[model samples]
Every structure is written in C-alpha cells, then in structure tokens.
Target chain A: MSIVVTYNKLVEFGDCDPARIVWFPNYFKWIDAASRNYFTQRGVPPWHATEREFGILGTPVVDTHAQFTNTASYGDVLSIHTRITQWRKTSFVMHYEVMRDHCSIMTCIETRVFAKHVGNTPDSSHHQIKAIPVPEFIKQLCGFSQ
Target chain B: MSIVVTYNKLVEFGDCDPARIVWFPNYFKWIDAASRNYFTQRGVPPWHATEREFGILGTPVVDTHAQFTNTASYGDVLSIHTRITQWRKTSFVMHYEVMRDHCSIMTCIETRVFAKHVGNTPDSSHHQIKAIPVPEFIKQLCGFSQ
Candidate 1:
C-alpha cells in the first residue's frame, strides 16, 4: 500500500450552485489537486522539473470513477485523502476519499498515465502526447515495491 | 429514446493548466451544465420552480464515470451532447459526449437522482436530502414513455 496524503480545502461560496450545495465539479477539482499533492508530499519533483529531466510532462487522468455520498455546502471544510492503489507499466490507479468532519463525502478512483510529448516538431499538429512506462525511480520515490 | 441536447462552451485561458491543456475538472463542469441543458431543452421547469410545485430540488449526481480520449487547450470550442440513457425509479443515467470539431474529446456517464428536502424545518440540522421517485411529468417532458 502506498502512503496516503491528505489535502485540505475550504469550500468557498463560489463553489456552490443555486441549490446551495457544493457543485459536484468542485469536488473533482479538489481531487485533482489532491492527486498532485500526493506526489509533492512524497518528494516527487514538480512536473516542469520532471519534464526537463525525464521528459514527463505530467500525469493525466485517462479514466475516472467517482461516487458522491454526502452533500456539502459552503463553509464546510473538506479533507481529501489520496493514494496510489496500483501501478501498471504505463499507468497507475489512484484512489481518493473526501471527508468532512470524518463523514464521507465522496470517493473516487482514477487511472492516470505518465505522459510525454511525442514527435520531433513541437509545432506540428501530429505532435501529440503519449503514455510512457512508469519510471522506476518515481515508483520507488512513491513507496512502490516490486 | 430521449432527444439529444447540445451545449456549447468556449474554453477560457484560465480553464487550462500549466501544461496548457484544459484541466480535467473543467470537463466535469461542462458535463454538469450539459445535463441541466438537456432538461431545459426538453421544456422542463427549472429546479426552483419544480421545488415550489413538486418539492423537487434538482437532480444530483450520485455516481459517474468519465473517459478522456484527447487533450484540448484554450480557445477551443467544445460541444457537449447529452441525453438520458436510462430512467430508473428514483435515479437516471445521463450520458455526455464532448467533441471539438466532431473529434471526440471525452465521454461521461453519470447516475443522478431527483432529490427533495426531507424535513419540515428548513433550519434543522437533520433536514437532509433524499432521493424521490422520478417525476412522471419530468420523464414525459424528456420523452421517456412506458
């Protein structure tokens, strides 16, 4: 099991909809932030630095599933717990649990890939992004064991 | 089969991440809007009006799955096509296809429920929300027929 990193967020008024509950999309935004925070907490360098050294632009979500259990409104504080649950050759699965005062708000599992820019000419329309093999060093840094 | 509703969006500069692609969460935002637009295009009353007449607040997403196929950047115009694929007793499934120039960007399917406030006192702490039976009028408006 990988280490769990907690990311805290304060629900802002703008994050709510006319129904006065937190808009569901805001939960996804926080989940994405928590995803990156997991790497930052694990001493993984920022994506720009990794791009420069390893040609990894960033990890991008390819597939995601989320379940919302409890509704929360503005003025609530949420803690998103995130961790990598599985690592594949070119992708990994991340799980997140969002809680408000220990009450479960939502849970999500996402498959993400380590992406790198492909093609020689960056300006070319065919210059697309492609998933690369999971680097050993990054796996080790994130407490993954073979 | 329900009629498909198309919702258009112009990607803003702030909607992109440092990697210059549209952030994943923004996709969810558009999907949600498309969900609402589907009802509006079908001539269903807004949530506020439904709340007054039938105690229906709105449909809230309970479960969702999304797949990202391609990356999009700022200044791109996206068209999201939404429709109800399944109508359960208290919950329904909404499907969305996001496209840029007919090129698939992402697709999402979400399960949502018709929600109503469950208590008499609006200020009560236990005044929680609960799923209600799918309003027949709503189903009819959206072209669902038994």
Candidate 2:
C-alpha cells in the first residue's frame, strides 16, 4: 500500500488571473509537483537517476480530470494531498486534493505512464517516448510488492 | 449557432519540460487564451466591461477534463479550435481541440459559470464570488439567440 503525501505551496501573484483568483491551470501545475513530491516522499530517486539505473525518462500524463470546489487567491497558502490510487502494468492513477484549512478547494485524478525514450524518429532524431511495463524495483520502492 | 474560432500559437522553448515536451499546464494556459479569444471574436466585451454593466467578474471553471493524444515540443506551431458546445441557464461548456498540422494533439471540455462578487464577510471585506444566471445579452452576443 502506498502512503499519502502532502505538498504545501504559497499561491503567488502571477498564479492568479485578472479575476484575482488562481487560474485553474495553475492547479494542474501544482498537482504535477505534488505527484513528484509523492515519489520523493517514497524515497524514490529523481528521474535523472533513471538514465543511469533504468534508462528511463519520466512519467507523462495521458489523461486528467479536475473539479474546482472553492476559489483561492494570491497570498493564500494551499496544501495538496496526493496518493497513488491504482497501478496498472505500465500506467498508474494519482488522486489529489487541494485544500485550504477545512475547505476542499479542488480534487483531481491523473493517469500517467512509466515512459522510456524508445528511439529517435526516422524523420528526425526527436526522442520518442512510450510506456514500458513498470519495473519491479521501482514498484517495490513505492511499496508495491509485486 | 456559435461559430468556431481558431487561436494560433507558438510553443516557446520555455514551455517545455526536462522531458523536452511542452509542459501540460501550458496547454491549459493556451486553451484559456483561446477561450477568451472566442469571446473577443464574438464581439463580446472583456470581463471588465461587465463590472459596470452587470457586476459580473468573469467565468469560473467548475469542472474540466483533458486528454493528451500526442507529445508536443518547443518550436511547434499549434492551433486550438474552440466552441461552446452547450449553454445551460447558469453555465456553459467549452470544447477545445488542439492540433499540430493535420494531427490532433489533444482535446478538452470545460464547464464554467458566470461569476460575480458578493458582499464582504462579517470578518473582513474579503470578496465572495458566486455564480449567476447566464445573461441573455451575453448569450446573444455569442450568437445564441433566445
């Protein structure tokens, strides 16, 4: 079983739109950060470590959904609670809740894949990424005893 | 009948992540700009215009979902096609399709409400926002007739 982690952030002035409320997209950014923090909390090394260990890049989001319950503004402090809800062969689902004290500001779920740079395209050397089966080592590190 | 609007954009180098792909959140940012462009193209005044005319602040997103179909990198030119697929009494849905040349890169659907500032709270003048019925004039301006 994976453990839940909390990532704290201060809403910056630039995070808000002309409406003075935090732009919705910023929530996704923070959620992505929180997702990384989840791995960090699990004692998983950063993505850079994989180039040497597993020849992997980083996970990429394939789908996401977010629902806003309350509004937030600059100068406000927010906490994002994150956890891996489910893990598939090559992809996993992350659940996140952004809160301000007792207020549940937003909730989100994302599907991300364990990706690797397969090779450069024939037309160009642009690296192509594809989902690979989750490694047993990485899974064990995240407390998934598979 | 609402006409679709296309917003052309250049993916800047700063928008890419360490993975060399455009960070996902930047897509939301462009989608937002495209949303506003839809209104601008429809001859609707900016949200600030509503302060005196209707006391409305702006649209606040209630829910949103997006799916990334392909990876995009810096120096890529993309176009977002946006349209209002449905308009309810108090909220409307915006559908966005992002394209690179002939490839469909991503798609999103957002539900948003017309918002306004209410009175200050007993503790402070902290502005409270609430949703109001979609104004008929605003709908008409978008080519949705009563």
Which of the numbered candidates is closest to the native, going by highest TM-score? 2
Off by over 4 Å in 2: A122-125
Query: What is the CAPRI rating of model 2's predicted complex?
Result: medium
Per-residue CA lDDT of model 2 for B1-146, tens digit only, reads: 66799999998889988888888999999998999899889887888998778988888889999999888888789999999989998999999999999998899999999999887668752456899999887788888864
DockQ of each: 0.63, 0.72
Please report the candidate that would top lDDT against the real structure.
1
lDDT of 2 at B107: 98
Question: Each candidate: what lDDT?
Answer: 0.89, 0.88
Docking class of 1: medium
Off by over 4 Å in 1: A119-127, B120-127
* Model 2 interface DockQ: 0.72
Deviation (Å) of B85 in candidate 1: 0.7
